[model samples]
Target: MTFAISKTASQIAPFRVMKILAQAKALQAQGRDIIHMEIGEPDFASPSCVHQAAQNAAEQGLTHYTATLGLPALREKLAQFYDGFYHAKVNAEQLVITPGSSSALQLVLTAILNPGEQVLMADPTYPCNRQFVHLLHGEVYSVPVTADSQYQLTLDHLKQHWNPQIKAVMVASPANPTGTLIEQAELLKMAQFLAQRDTYFIVDEIYQGLVYERPAESILAHQNLPQNVVVINSFSKFFGMTGWRLGWCVVPEHLIDVLDRLGQNLYLSAPTLSQYGALAVLESDALTELEQRRQIFQQRRNRLYAAMQSAGFTLKTLPQGAFYLYWDVSEYTQDSERFCAALLQQTGVAITPGTDFGKEAGKSHVRLAYTNDRIEEAVQRIQGFVEQYR
Candidate 1:
């Protein structure tokens, strides 16, 4: 019996890292000591306070559905967080909490895009960014960016690619695969450019709190930001709440009703217990714990940067934030997916092939997520694997 699938489902690309991770898991089951560096989840657990909050909520039987937009208290807490942290005047009415940043992105895209319209994005970004557009029957126009631009889209790139068909421009800062950020000034410039044209601007700030050298600011914090702009953020990264599956989006006030309806239909609400736990995550103690964990991630980034360099791989751009190091492995192999497969099979170590991020220029690269506790051991195994190829 043949089952018919929608064209959207058929066109979506697979996340190649999961395939590598599955193979690594199979090897581990066979008594192999596989050191994982493929996935982008933190090794740390959620803060104790968060866990306790969830437990307490469960004990009180607060496990039912929340308001479609979110619990009023959670939305208020998030609004306060943005105002206190960044001085961004965010009102609770503009916030819509979702199961994760992924869904927040989906809501924004679905709310703004009409079928066959184009959305501009940087190439070599999070693969799902484009796929989400495809799921809505929207076209993705990828502007190829390089290390010089920190793998971020530039004003000139936008000017070159901007067309009448384009409806939105989406970007991720402290971007995935590269972990580089768009400078605040450049972001403001892009915001102004889009504002003048009345084009929609979407900024993914999921890695905001994890920045190392400089702080990553949200576009919503930009004064006089375009009314069409939307900001996507999550509790999964710095807050160490990956399994909680909680995140929120800041959209124009006018879209709140539309988004509320979409949220009602799509998820009804975010997880009730997670919302309660996230309230504790905003407490002073949780912030301190998260900052300490961030320092550890920075240490891992420094160690991995050094290790990959010593192993004859050059990073195109040094990672300034997030827990990933994207490497240029052209000298060792042009086919990164093949290189990753051989490395994992030979050394029991896993890294994400750059091909998982993008096709152009991505084939010569790979992404190593420093989310493991055994970074030194993974480094050693990686070095040994590189020696065989050299």
Candidate 2:
């Protein structure tokens, strides 16, 4: 039987990363022996304490449904996290936990945008942000970012694209794929400017704790009261719990009730076990485990930086935050997707094409995920691939 689908759903294509990943996986299944860098996932498993917490939760029959707003304990702990990291206090009443940050984004877009409204974001950033806009029947106004600006969004660019139909501005710090962050000064300027109008401001902080050189700042640190920022965070990155489908958002007090209703209808509540596990992340000794991993990622980031530079590709920016390297391959090849695919086939190396992030700058770029838990082997394989290309 032919199944029915929404008109909006029919118009959009599948997430490009997953499509490429599926092709790469299929090739590997044929004994291709691909060295995976195409997908963005942590190499480490969830920290042992987190796993133990999940076990305890399941054994306690915490499997029963929780408040749509999230378990009270988890919410309180996340509030403390805001105060600690961002140096800003958030009430638990402002929080709503959802299946994943991805789903949280959908509700934020749906809650605010009228059909045909515009949602603004940087083009050379996350692909899924654009997809979320489309899924909500909204248009995207891409703010073009350049390597000179560290590929981060600026307040000036915000003004260039802002319009009457635009309802919100979506930005990610330590942004996905690019791994670039919006500077705190620029972030404040953008927040203050948006406050001049009725526009909503949403900040995605999924990569908050992954920074290497400098700590990634949160919008909560600087935004004014009545909390104009709808801040999002996830357990997937820092907790090494990507498979857990857990995330939280802090809305304006007025927005929380609406978000809770949406959470109940859409998610029911983030997986019960993951919620209990993330409680440990927010409230317990999880920070020590996270810090240990951070040191390792910092070293891998340095290793990948040197390797890419010596390999003859340009070092546009050596990612100040997040675990990615978005650099130019234009001097070597124009078709990044084909270059990546051929490299994966020939050298057993898989890196994501720039186009997977955005169509404008993507033609000449590729993103290298330095997610090597056993990084030496990944680095050596990359070094070998570079020599062969010579």
Question: For each predicted model, how many residue pairs clash, with residues at least 3 apart or on different chains?
Answer: 0, 0
Q: Rate the local accuracy (lDDT) of all candidates.
A: 0.88, 0.80
Task: Please give the lDDT score for candidate 2.
Answer: 0.80
Clashes of 2: 0
User: In candidate 1, which residue pairs get closer than 3 Å at backbone N, Cα or C atoms, i.e. clash?
Assistant: none
Q: Each prediction's TM-score against the native?
A: 0.97, 0.94
After TM-score superposition, what is the CA distance of residue 44 in candidate 2 from its true location, in Å? 0.6
**Runs of candidate 1 exceeding 4 Å displacement:** none
Give one digit per residue, the lDDT tens place, for model 1 in 88-207. 889998999999999999998999899999999887889999899999999988887888888889998888888889899998888998889988789888878887887888988899
State the local distance difference test value for candidate 1: 0.88
